[model samples]
Target chain A: MNTLKINYKNIYYPPGGILMWIIIFLELITFGMALVAFVYYGNEQRELFHHSRMQLNTTFGAINTVFLLTSGFFMANAVHQFKEKEIQKSSVFFKLAMLGGFLFLGLKSIEYYHKIESGISLDTNMFYTFYWLLTGFHVIHVIMGLVILGWTNYGMTKKDSDTITEDVEACAAFWHMCDLIWLLLFPVLYLIF
Target chain B: MQKSLIFVYGVLIALTIATALIANFMLVSPFVVSLIMGLAVFKFSLVTFQFMELKKANSFWKVSLTLTLGLIVLLIIFLK
Candidate 1:
């Protein structure tokens, strides 16, 4: 009879191993959907899909890839510093990674603005549809990373090392996952065209 | 300061610049672009596994991640 009465927050707070599994599950689903879109495009109108892909701005894709890889490096540094018990330096790296995420969002928005100005949009065609869906979904994850980093920053100022270390590791894992996804995406979406 | 770390960083930066130039000016063949991208992935894996100390992570976690990547790559090939 477990009567310790854990709070709702405790159940939800990440770095709880269960939450990592849940995040992995969600990632698998997104990856599956993207795969399905690719297959569908393959069967229906392959040439149109290839033609539409050329309309994408590869320069922006390359820039975003660089930004994501930089963010992952900072995140790795943050976790490394956390293990070293240098909380202040870890926090700095975390903030740097967060800044990288913001820079990515800024570049993505600029790309989107030009896209919209050129009269292209989500529903314009299958290629644009997958383009917006996949990239937009990634942007949402980047925003979530920012929010988590903001909270982790607050924790860094107040919490003990063990707690903060856990948070930093979890966020680093998520950030690295973001970086990995973009690695695949950059080649598939941009270079392939 | 480990020389290996510095050497790895130098290679990563060089590869990055090279990839950008190839994408922009050279317009290399798709196979070469993929080769460059694959190298980038390898670089990042080294950074994550060795530099970040994930090399000793639980086997289950590593296997799962690798499987996910494999599946995703297969799907992308089918797309092409």
Candidate 2:
């Protein structure tokens, strides 16, 4: 007990493992830099930016925001439940979380469809360029997140799954990273001009 | 933990509604833009601290995430 307490207090390992955290920080830097560049171009093409903003549907964006928030909420619950050794419950929560991700993808794909139909391709303008590249990159991450969550779910079903707690936590961290990036993207791409 | 998770979800959803309303109803201005971005930062921190459990993370993780969001928001606001 004393050793455990000392380790907890002194060493302070991050949740979801250190490697995942490193990946997260790197991902954040990449997305942050892209957004900064987008802002720089936004300043140059103010009118174009405004027009692109008008083209987006904030209602769809808000719905997707809810989808991600709810998904992250479920993923966090899954992590907590797994820690408590409630494997069944945790698996359920993770599935719900995956459902949320799919919903987000569905809505976002609809938005992309509208853009493509209206002749708003990647080269439509500077704002559209950032919109396609940044948000498209984010869409890929969402798809990847689904794969991670599914893998974690598979891990939960196997014998000795409890021993792979770090994998579960790492997957949760990645899903939440997707959630976090969308929190940034929804505002920049949908709400703010 | 469950209660706090629920509370965070509530706040995040409410903030989403608020973002939509402001965009649809309010007059567009720099202040409005900043407000939208501010709300985005708030939502981002909520997910990071609550879902990511960064609140319990080491100081370095906490500071790093905060500074990353800070840099992006500042660049967006000032650069434009």
Candidate 3:
């Protein structure tokens, strides 16, 4: 039993849990399926897609991409620091990560405001339909990730290293999912034109 | 962990800039869209392998996730 215990300590398993991977798998398929549908429709209406795509502001999308990537970077660092037994440093990095998320949301809101003010509603066109659904869905995930990160930040204040580790790892996984989804979306919606 | 993760992020940020430049400044070309989408796939790999800590996980995990990403990229390419 003692030998088994010592061996278990050295094994590096995935952070978070296996079920989170399952969820990630499912979530990615759902988005991919949706994107495929978008691509099909866009291909059928290539001219319309081209016209509507021009209405979008790549500048905002590019900036938001940076925001999310920076957030993901900080989140990875947060997990690393947490593993190193630096609770205070981990919390600081997590806060910075959250700040990036919030900034992305703020900029996204502005982008939405401009789109709405320009009279571009969800029903404006087929391309807009996919745009609202895909990006709005992503925004919801970002919100959910922020909430989880908030709880993870609170967990770091406690003295229990074991639970803190799990919380941080799980939070990092979820946040990175957000980043990954955005990577797919940015190229499809903003960069394809 | 810190140094390697930082390096991954640096590469990712640089790729982000490259994608933007290619998409915005480059004129219309048959291969442009393919290149942009390819960068997305590369970025996805970095995020999965480095940030998601899949690099330390079992091979089964890495392979399955990569296959899934590949399938998605293929679907996009077919339509593009």
Candidate 4:
């Protein structure tokens, strides 16, 4: 019987690996600074921000939030099942996670289509500049996350597979980073002004 | 473990809906923004600790993540 081993006491070996955590921190900080800048500019042009924010669809944003959070839940479960040596169950969860990601992208694409059709662009206004840049960047991350999950899922389910707990954990950490970033972005972009 | 994961998922979905409702139905104001952001922060912590498995991580990682989130939230509130 194979069992996963991790040193919880070791700061250098946090869950999903130290390197992944470092990347997570760096990503968080990068997004955090952008959010701060968004708020600063939002305050500078209060009416513009408010009016532009009104143009956004909170319903789509809210639905996307649910999508990503549910995806993150499936991802965590995938990792948990992997650790339990339930490879088939883990694969099923991985597929479900990817499905959630796809649904988010689908909804986001529809939203983006509406915005573009309405002639909203990055140069539209202060509020929209932040909107396009932040949400566009986040969409790229979701696409990348889906790709990673695809590769990881393939590796885990293939014949003579060598996928390990660390691999799934690292993939999950990356996916959840997308969730975390959206958690920050959704409120600031779609809800709060 | 499955039970706990489902519980967390339910809480996350509930909070997401609550935040959206507060933002949509209520008038936009500093107080409303604060409440919404507060819920965002709480949801953020839930995902970080529970979904990301940071709960099982070193105290250093946990504290650093929490502090970073706090700083970001403070900045948003203060600047907004």
Give interface RMSD, per candidate. 6.5, 1.9, 3.0, 1.1
Candidate numbers sorted by TM-score from highest down: 4, 2, 3, 1
lDDT of 3 by residue, B1-80 (tens): 47888899899989999998998898645488889989999999999888877877777778888999899888887887
Q: In candidate 4, residue B28 scores what lDDT?
A: 80
The estimated TM-scores of all candidates read 0.80, 0.93, 0.93, 0.98
Given the true complex, what DockQ would model 2 score?
0.69
Colliding pairs, model 1: none
Model 3, CA-based lDDT? 0.86
The regions of model 1 sitting more than 4 angstroms off are A1-18, A39-44, A159-162, B1-13, B21-37, B40-44, B47-52
DockQ of 4: 0.82
lDDT of the candidates, in the order given:
0.67, 0.85, 0.86, 0.92
Candidate ranking (lDDT, best to worst): 4, 3, 2, 1
Per-residue lDDT of A1-193 in model 2, one digit per residue for the tens? 1111112112346777788888888988899889888888888887889888898888888899899899999999998887777889999999999999999999999998998999999888888888899889889999999998998798787787654666777899999999888888887777667
Q: What is the TM-score of candidate 1? A: 0.80
Candidate 3 lDDT tens digits, A77-141: 98877777777898899999999999999999999999999999899999999999999999999
lDDT of 4 by residue, B1-80 (tens): 49999999999999998998899799888899899999999998999889888888889999999899899989999898
Candidates 2 and 3, the one with greater DockQ = 2
Q: In terms of lDDT, which candidate is strongest?
A: 4
* Candidate 4, A47-84: lDDT as tens digits: 99989999999999999999999999999999999999
Off by over 4 Å in 4: none
Clashing pairs in 4: none
As a whole number from 0 to 100, the lDDT of residue A92 in candidate 1 is 89
